[model samples]
Target: MQHRHACERRETGGDRWTEAEREAVARDHRDAARRHRHRGGDEDRGGFRHKTFVRRLRKCFEDHGRFAGADLTRKQALRDFFEEILLRRRLSDHHSFTLLGDLRDAPAKRFPGELTRRARALTPHLLTTDAAAGRASSARPCVVLVEADPASSRVATSAVATAGGEVAAAFSSQKAAASVPGTVLAIVDVPDRGALDAVDRLVAAGLMVVATSGAGSVALAVEAMRRGAVDFVLKPYTPEALARRLAPRFAEVGQHVANASEADRAKADFGAFVGSSPAMLALYDEIARIAPSRAPVFVTGESGAGKELCAEAIHARSGRAGKPFVALNCGAIPRELMESEVFGHVRGAFTGATEDRAGAVEAAQGGTLFLDEIGEMELSLQAKLLRVLQTGEFRRVGEAHARTADIRIVCATHRDPQVEVAAGRFRQDLFYRLHVLPIRLPPLRERGADVETLANEFLKRFASEEGRAFRRFSPAAMERMRAHDWPGNVRELQNVVRRAVVLGEGEEITPEMLPAEVAAGTQRLLLERIDEAEVEPFWMTERRVIERAVAVFGGNTARAAAALEISPSTIYRKRERWAELGT
Candidate 1:
């Protein structure tokens, strides 16, 4: 009955709650919260008394069933209203968390927009303040106008602002467009070849460029496309017409521009890492949360997955940012001199020890010591290292007195430490001591579009170093790169991009310019898919290979097994099963 009355009242009130209705609903909520408190249920934990909150939410839904009008979807309308209410009410953090959690866990079908603004605005410490700031900055899409004439630029800026966008900056030259940050798009009036070159630079900076050319300058339009302009418009276009034409492009690239801006911001915080993928962002958040601590951090990842960089990031974020960060590669050093490398050597300690020398630990005093490939450290050394960690003291080679150590230990290993422990190659206690805080880096293949971000960054860097004209990757080359499984990870990708920049002569890198291995593999996979009509069963294929191997080995199963890297008993068992199946 109350829901029906609310709906009728809402219908009469022109699809919006009246001031009296809002106060009545707010009063009801407060009364329910008071009742919950009187029932001995903590307000912080209960979060608006779940049952009553849902009842109110459903009532609002019913009253506002047609509130979306035609332009706004029901989901968006609910979210906008909810956000406005939250802002007006100024809910407590605990209440907001509980409310957002319930909304987050609910099915997306029931709520579109997922209350993204609300969740981002309410998430504790993660995006709360930053999200608010981003919201403010993104209230209007920002456009950069690159027109040489002052009067024309003023006109364009006013048009853009009037068209529901903000003029982030107005530059008279295309050369200045590349430096503009947090822009959705750039409007470039290309009158000459120099402006066309500027279009290239802006595109290289990841901004979508819209080149405006005179109607008779068909050659200029063609050149603009070649120079990487996404869309070109003929001059003498009106604000409404231009806006209509560019609206679709803006919608398409809006999210991408936002992400690029976010990545740029993230670069300021995580200097060594260059990605905004969810995995990377989560990793960044984790690093920030854990940076202030003094616990030893153990980083584990594939050889080129940036374990050392992760350690550096942790150190940079920690209290030791201003201190020295000494890194030692345990695998690169010889086992015979491992002890002397970790602890400084006294004079006359060995044949080469002519004078006193400080090792990595000493060099890293009051800072961080990054030990890469630590699993390669011998058991004897591991035991000694464990003592230093426990006692905070170490003795130099051939020294009788122990020196105090005041440094954080951050160790990394490509190999599994547990496997080394089981093999008795590493001390168990040392592993435990360093493994207090463990960070596992995801391989590049799993980082998704981060591959593109990293590839572009590497291209820009290497292109300048090599003094090449390489500006960007051709679409085909980029697709092939994203398709390939990067076995060697980021290091391999870096080398590939560097090689392409060195050998390629054109402004855009093509598929042929890529290393033969990556290009050929892509072609081979495509050919395999197209040429193979019938797929053979795994057992048939396995039998064919095994039969061929046995024939090549003169019918000796053991020799074939040895060549195939499988047990001879396993081959015999497979042969018995094949015979029974009459294959």
Candidate 2:
């Protein structure tokens, strides 16, 4: 009976102490409780009552040496009894299980079957719950985890589903390859080269694969990359870390698929101008307002500020969308042939006019005429264009009769039309006619919080077009992008994002992927100086010119002095003075 009692005590975690030791601990606990109660100083009545109850329980344990003999062999009996008492005392609380205290030195328990069963029961419920919650369309995309081990797969599926991704299906490697669509990006725990071979097959079949090995072998990861795996996340990763790595890729894939499926729907839709910034929203509203009108529209902005895109948007939304929307570059047309190109000519109109032909205006009759670089149009041609706008009629060179065109006109220029008009380079009347609906596009730098949205949109586009698995921009890359002034504007931003997407090998696009000028924020500073120059006095132009030269030379005093045709000492002195003035 004593032996049985000792065994019971051992099972119940009481064997670590002798009866005397137990009594000593109980006395110590009671004393501690009494001290706590006294520390309350009678003001904390509830604390005193709590401490008194604990002291009473300790005293009872010391006196009895044990609780009621209720299966003392059960390791959980004491815990259950304590939990019950805690509930009864209104102290019920859930705490994290301390593995060191709960299972230290105990024989490791294997309940794989129970874990597997629980995961299976939980996974579908989790997926169904997420679907009901309508989380599939949220910004964060979901990943479907697959493993050969049924238990591991179940756990992975449950975790991913709970994270708001639809687990399309989970199976063994062979089954996953056969059953899973090429669109489903697979995350596999590669056990060996054979597992890698399965990934290879999936890749060959045009599916995106991300393989992970808990062992963290570079060989497997490199091999996977070489075999066209989108990313390789090593284990043992927490659910959060894995999700972070996989979500963007999944989102990219889903976005591409959606875009591809709806190509027809998006044909007339403006290219992915993803932004909700106030400026962007306003621009969109402006596009909608003036698109259907037949009035002559003029778009003005910096070089890469997407003036052409605005023109396209106007054309796409206009009543003549189904008709040809012709574009001609006045600056690109040779000066000698600019008149013939604009007005069209008979066979004898000019040396190059081989046959009777139509001008851009005639070609775009009943549609839209897009004139880029209108400010660059020669002075003589500007007079003819003014006549065309005034009368809506033009006679082809050497042709007797005037041909009238019924077309909506859109013109874009990077130069300041008012300056040109004041300088007598452009006709003020023509400027007014073309400026019937003027749209001034803001530079990429001024479009707050739109950089990220535009970057993401470009990433999706280039990834699809290039058949790559590009994902999201890294936080550092995003910061660098936001810091840039984007002198070239949206067109420049689009190119940068496209380049990053194509060149980026990791799941995140880094600052290194950006152009050196943009990554270093040099362009931003230059743009700021330009802005300052606009407000500076005419006499300050010389200083501004020198300052720009210094910046171009990377603040090298000797180089800046050489560029400015001044001495190095002079450059240094000016810099010092500018510093003192806090310019």
Candidate 3:
């Protein structure tokens, strides 16, 4: 019972609550309730009701505080709501609270039983003054944001705020040294050794720290780890990354909401990859959640769905971001040379080995190694890769000495690893080793509405690159694109736009520039099914015949008119009219 009480005290706080102190806090709360009921005026609500706020408050409370007792539960809950929501200032005495509505009289103590009843029902019965009593004052275990550099502070602050954390204050090393009490976690934007020293000091003070750097070195990271940082975030990172690193730690301390709403907010694009579809957003959240670890990450996506982009984002968010990000395409390398290419060879080891060389593992020392098309690597190489992953030990080709790489492995393949394992093409043990955190990217076709957005982005980029006046997609073109099934995914879309930007002339890219199957849409399907029964306006039919003839003859106007039995000038006039109408 003594041991259990010690643990409970730690949960509530380091100093156990005295019976007098609990009664004092309970009395303070009752006085505040009285003031709210009698003298205080209410503020107007735009659309949100106080009840709705109460529901959210309870949900956040349950998420952050898993308090396990009825003895002081009401006091604890009311304290959390006031501190976390209202952010009320601590009383001058630090032993009790001030009443609401500027009631200058000191709150008088009430009987213990009455105090308990009022505290129990306080949250639901909170008046406008009770909840709005104090603003922006704080207490112990507050999460602090420390960024010395003024230029980068905004980014770091925005990241932490977007993650749903209540930042107590922003300070530098000077201010931190001045005020170090009761900080839960300090996310320091480290730009140099001075910041590292601050981190070490904070750690020494028993404050958890997350060190962030934009252009950091391996020495900084290693030293930060030695000084006891919980995690390291590379700068210019998304808010989700900062949030994820803090999430689990804050959950343990009863300062974070590790719920679905927070996870869903991370659905926005991460780094270079763009999408808000549930799957992509989930992938972004997963990356943010796992980027701090040194575990091997396996990424799977169809060809051109940007698997490599995901790998880069992971490496960027990880502690190893300051080091080289070496990438190798296992399928692109020759089978016979794969071993030497990965592990390297000494001079004269092979016919082409003119001098000693290092491979991907060595090149990526103290960083990340991204292996694309991993499933296509030969089976013999798979065993060697697995061995390295298992023991972090490897040997160079034709060399007696062994070598090890301090590198994180990120493997990617378009084919399903399970299917490959079943077929005996991929090694089962190797798959398991690299599959600790698997990120499967959805094909572009499955991400609805993202297609049009992606199309607009691509078109805008290509327009500037090609120096074209092209701006928007015509309504007909956008509808056709949205309806068309993109079998080739993002890569195919990029290529189609690139071709159109090069050949297209008008401001609006019309259906004429789109592929036959894509542009025809409903009409194309009808034509394919009915063969000869499809009808069209006379001019439209003429236009189709001329287009087919010109396309077939490689844009030779004379040949096209000859194929259609029309004068060359007549075909030219129709083409000019179409161009004039921006079609």
Candidate 4:
């Protein structure tokens, strides 16, 4: 009875009791048990609880006897419990113990070391493989496993660790952004659509992501790629396959880091613009001719036709290349703040203005100011702009003094200035002033055969950004690209190429990897054109025939008319009329 009480007291005191106190308790328990055995007392075996107590005491004695020479701590007791309950149950083969509480607060010194020893003992067989265990232990790159399902967490951790990566943390989508660090690669098991928000946050932080799910939906995979995942591995992945998939990505990540180290070495080479079409070459020539001059250049093109790039080229090649090159989208600024943004403003000029501020024009002094979407500017502001263009002088809001403008202006617009002037939406004088050195950028469709070159360029850029090993597009994919009309222009083409880079599973990008809208739109348009049988007006039919012939003849108008069995004079007249009608 005395020994039973002593053992209970030691168990209750836990790690707070010293080893000497534990030994004293054990001695007292042995003395009482021996006395009870000699007396053959049925009182100790009167109930099941007494029997269980005796059994626990005997097991403790056996464990202590086995490790009698070594010192034992309360943490070792806990570890033994874990090995019996968790490890024996196959809950986890390898343990990565992260101490949650401060060691200074620990009641005993040996607790931490005992726990560490136990974890070392359970190291799994798979972790001993050469490819799996050869990574640096101190500088291990963090691999975050995001899984809401408890059942898959162990499997994911084991597989990732076997691939020479460490599972830094595990989190559900709801907690991923807050828990994941920037350096960690987020591996998400997105089981449903609700997890997309978590995926989006990970992407916004610029963390490399790898998503998986049991569902084999290609749409989900595509969506994951669109949200900036580096790769998507389906569930039930073997350790070898997981390692193979991650190996190249790890190498590419190393390259990206190396490249970033020498980022300044990469110059904005004008030769980097990838296109050999006549229109592109002509635009390049125009940029070269006008870059050295201080003229107010006007760029016109459909949206996403690289008008801003043309502006950049001009600035980069000009004397102002060494100076600041400021760019602003006229359409993006709020109407109420447009004047204040363009010209200097004094304190108290507006609600949010607490101090005097220089406007964009003054900010670009001695440099080039690129005004994108200039047609979106209000007509009232156009007159003030014309004055600045004519006299190079302007005044700040709520200020009495006038300031001289010393900046060069480069403007771009997708709208037709003639149409805006006819509609009384733009001042004709301002239009004429801006049109002095007009340079119209041809759209992607008009660039003819440049699509493949631009696609490959974008493919390389996005692949490098994503840390993938994709090289090029398949032949069928290239044919599909050429067959489609890019209504969103170059921007659309860039997005498609980026999407393909992310979603492609192999080195070559396939048509199946393209967005359904792109492939479907081309097919639908082709079918619609083929099914059309209605006869149109003679002029309309003539225009259609000429357009088709021109496409077939690769934009040779003379050959186009000859193929249509019509005189070149009639074709030219119709084209001139079409141009006048703004078709």
Task: Please provide, for model 2 over 1-583, each residue's C-alpha lDDT reduced to its tens digit, 9 standing for 90 to 100.
Answer: 3423553565465524344434444454446656866776452222335435534543433333243222322213333333344443344232211211121112224222322222222232222222222323244343434575534654455345444454544445554443243235667778666677777767776667778777678897888888888888876665567667767776778777775545434333556455556676678778989998889999998898788888888988889988878889988989987777777889976676779988898998889889999988988788888888888988888899999988888999999999999999898988988899999988888887878878888888888898887778878788778888788888888899888877778677887888997788845645666764368675367678887888898888689888778898886787688788887
The lDDT for every candidate, in the order shown, is 0.75, 0.66, 0.68, 0.69
User: How good is model 2 by TM-score?
Assistant: 0.46
Model 4 scores a TM of 0.45
TM-scores for all candidates: the values are 0.54, 0.46, 0.46, 0.45
Candidate 4's residue-wise lDDT over 341-374, tens digit each?
A: 8986999987989999999888988898999999
Alpha-carbon error at 218 in model 2, in Å?
44
Candidate 2 minimal-lDDT segment of 10 residues: 96-105
Predictions ranked by TM-score, top down?
Answer: 1, 2, 3, 4
Per-residue CA lDDT of candidate 3, range 1-583, in tens? 3323433564666434444443444344444444544655342231223333333333333433334233243334434444533433223322222222112121323223333223222321111221222221243235566766644554454444445444455566555552344456778777877777778777887777888887668888877878899888887776567767777776655534333334335433364875666666777878899899999999988898998888999999999989999999998998999898888889989898999999888889999999999988999989989889988988888899889778999999988899999999999999999999988888886787777878898999999999999999998888788777677778888887888889999899898998887875656445446746566578888788889999999989999889889999999899899899887
Of models 1 and 2, which has the larger lDDT?
Answer: 1
Number of the predicted model whose lDDT against the real structure is largest: 1
Best by TM-score: 1
After the best TM-score superposition of candidate 2, give how far the Cα of residue 202 lies from its true spot, in angstroms: 31
Candidate 3 TM-score over all chains jointly:
0.46
Residue 100, candidate 2: alpha-carbon lDDT = 14
Give per-residue CA lDDT, model 1, range 472-547, as digits (tens). 9898998888777788889999999998888778899899888877775576447547745577789999999998
Q: Over 4 Å off in model 1, which ranges? A: 1-258, 523-583
